[model samples]
Target: MKHLTILVPDAQTSLNTFACIIGAYDIFTRANQHWVGQGKDPVFTVCLAGVSENAVIQQDIMSIRPEFRLSQVAGTNLILIPAISLDFERPEGGNIELTGWIREQYNKGAEVASMCSGGLMLASTGLLDGKSCSIHWNAVDKLKNLFPRVLVKTERLITDAEGIYTNGGGYSFLNLVLYLVEKYYNRETAIYCSKIYQIEIDRQNQSAFTIFTGQKAHGDEVIRKAQAFIEDHFREKISVQDLSTRFAVGRRNFDRRFIKATGNTPVEYVQRVKVESAKKSLESTRKTISEVMYEVGYADVKAFREVFRRITGMSPLEYKNKYNKEGADLAAMS
Candidate 1:
């Protein structure tokens, strides 16, 4: 049987963290039960392991006591890290011992997976260094700033590189668990759990859910000015050459500085700003996709659709149908 340890973090955590822990345990255990019901032996030995005997969460609203402390588990086949509160300034959240233990387990040939913001803890262990990791979109900028060595894939729902798995924000972690279930057990078992939990299987991207708030925390006055200008005039046909000239900087020099400060090229920043504005219009107004596109300064329908899909993983019409209740109702009526 594969030994699967769900880590109960030794830090103040959100209700989301509690849900991930309980949810993972319930799903994996149920997978075993399902196998047993089929007259087959259990596939996993699941346990809740922790650095401390009990960890209080969410201002002591609840406490979790692990089945075994980290010290007690000399080794395991798999270690799952649940989401904990992420202080971007201190991504580790003072869980030094926990990170160390995780690194040790991983070095001992155990697979590690982190759910949502739990990628912060997993990244802290240095296991994700030079590896692709999926994290909550909200934390992408912070993760990039803190762990420059780690390749952060904000659009991906799940990233599996060398046995270290990570998933995107919130309840999307359920999808990652389903993926592991399929890998560790069988596709049939994963499908059974997915049905029981009502989780959509094979969800590959979280880009549709991301709200692109441009990164502006850097210490570059010129770049900040450029960003504000783009945001303020996203509806205008703003070109990089125009921006560079207006800012009194050479084109190549401006491009280098913009990318260094904002992690986006000048053209990408302009596209993101325009797309973000288009998204809001589609969500709140009774505008057609073409109207929204034109309002955001895109005259070409095909080009607008391409950029929208590239950034959001959904077409403008699809995004509207998903987020605009009135639009969805109108479509249903039609």
Candidate 2:
């Protein structure tokens, strides 16, 4: 039997999708565990994750006989997130801690995935960047608005961008868990698991943008070079011909596989990184808009401003104004 753990601010708290995974995964003949009263007994855990329950459960976990720390996290094979904190508008506090642990597990070969807004936490950690990822539609605006580096998309169930898969909401969690079971055990096991959970397995065809087979192979020499090019010249004008020549593939072939795997055309993806870098510059430096534009490889202020507004829905000046105001508030407190 496989192990699945759900993390939560409180065990008493309930988020819809997280709770559903627990009930859904059990049908795969897998045992499960949850963090309760602030104590996660890693000794008996196979998975580690959060819950979608109410804060009362969170209070219960906080009041655990001992205390909660990521002790059992090492034993976790899979991680599941029910939903995210409602009170915390962004992925902060315990949520960040949880994402960090998942990242740790992912590095060590453990499978990590999430449902609904949980993708925000996964994405925020840079875990889902350079990969296919998705989140709830309502939350997508804020996600793209903030994380320009990630290829955020819309999906009804799960988008498996490489190994990091995310769903649209809680009910989608059931599909993901069942899919996970199918991956490890067998299609039959997933069927039995779904049967036990009384969940549907036949989801309609989803976008090519959502699911990924997994990250590029462990040691793909070609992809490594492409990655380097993307980092060094992302802000510059990079053509598919440029990338294809390096990979020794024709431009057409290169574009298809790159988009199929990365969820964006070469230009769209690089622009995303440049936009992200611009955001950082806007937040941290006092460079004028023109300097910032050239710094990010765009010489035309009008063009850059238009693209920035289109993606983030705000002028660069507006972004700086908002960012500066927040910084000022923090400085005054200090």
Candidate 3:
């Protein structure tokens, strides 16, 4: 049987962390039971392993205690890291031994998977260096800042690189769990669990759920002013040249600084601001796609649709249909 060790982190973790740990354990255990019920041997031996035997994580009003400590596990086929708190500095500072242990396990040929913000912990192991990783979209900027060597794919729902798996934000980690089920078991078993847990299988991206709040924490006064200008006039035709001239910076220098600070080009930033505005209108107002597009200063229908889909993984209409309750209700009746 494959040995699956879910790391019970000894740090201030989010409430979702507990859910991810219990949820994964329950699903994997169910998978084993399903196999046993089918006259087959169980596939995995699952256990929750922590840094220390006495480690107890308290979040809000609840507590979690792992069944085994990391030192006791001589070897394991797989290691799972669940979402921890977003105050990554605190966890990284406190969980030095945990990260070191994860590194050792990975070096010993064990597969590691991180759920949601757990990517921060896995990335700390240096196993994800130069490898693609997906985390909660909201934490993308922070992860990028902390681990510049790691390729953070904010759009992907799941990233599998050389046995290191990472997933997107929130309860979307359930999708990654289902993916692990299919990988370790079979498609039939994965489908069975998906039905049992009511999780939508084969979700490939988390872009639709992302709210494009631009990264402004970088201390670049000029870039910050430029960002504010873009946000203030997103409904106007703002060009890179115009922005550069207005800011009194050279074109190349402006582009470089903008990208370094915001992780987006001036044009890209402008598009995102406009699209975000359009999204709000679509969600809250009784407006046609054309009206919303024009309101966001998108004169070209094709251009607007393409950019919207590229950023959000959904067309304007699809986004509206998904997020706008009134529109969905009307469509249902129609």
- Provide backbone clash counts, one per model: 0, 32, 0
Q: Arrange candidates by lDDT, highest first: which order? A: 3, 1, 2
- Compared with the true structure, all predictions reach lDDT values of 0.88, 0.60, 0.91
TM-score of 2: 0.49
Clashing pairs in 3: none
Q: Which stretches of candidate 3 lie over 4 Å from their true place?
A: 90-94
Off by over 4 Å in 1: 58-60, 88-94
Residue 65 C-alpha lDDT in model 3: 90
lDDT of 3 by residue, 145-238 (tens): 9999999998999999898999998999899999999999899999999999999999999988888889998999999999999999988899
Among these predictions, the greatest TM-score belongs to 3
lDDT of 1 at 178: 97
Per-residue accuracy of model 2 over 1-334 as CA lDDT, tens digit each:
3455555543212445335444544543341222122243322234333422222233322321112346544556666665664333445545556667778878876666777677766776778777766675555655665576777665445677556767766466677777776676557656765676687885632331232222333354565567568877877777778899978988887777766555557776676667767877887887777888999999888889887765555688877776766655665688
Task: Give candidate 2's whole-model lDDT.
Answer: 0.60
RMSD of each: 1.5, 16.2, 1.1
- lDDT score, candidate 1, position 121: 81
Better TM-score candidate (1, 2): 1
Candidate 2 stretches with Cα past 4 Å from truth are 1-3, 10-14, 17-21, 28-68, 86-89, 204-334
Find the 10 residues in a row with the least total lDDT in model 1.
86-95
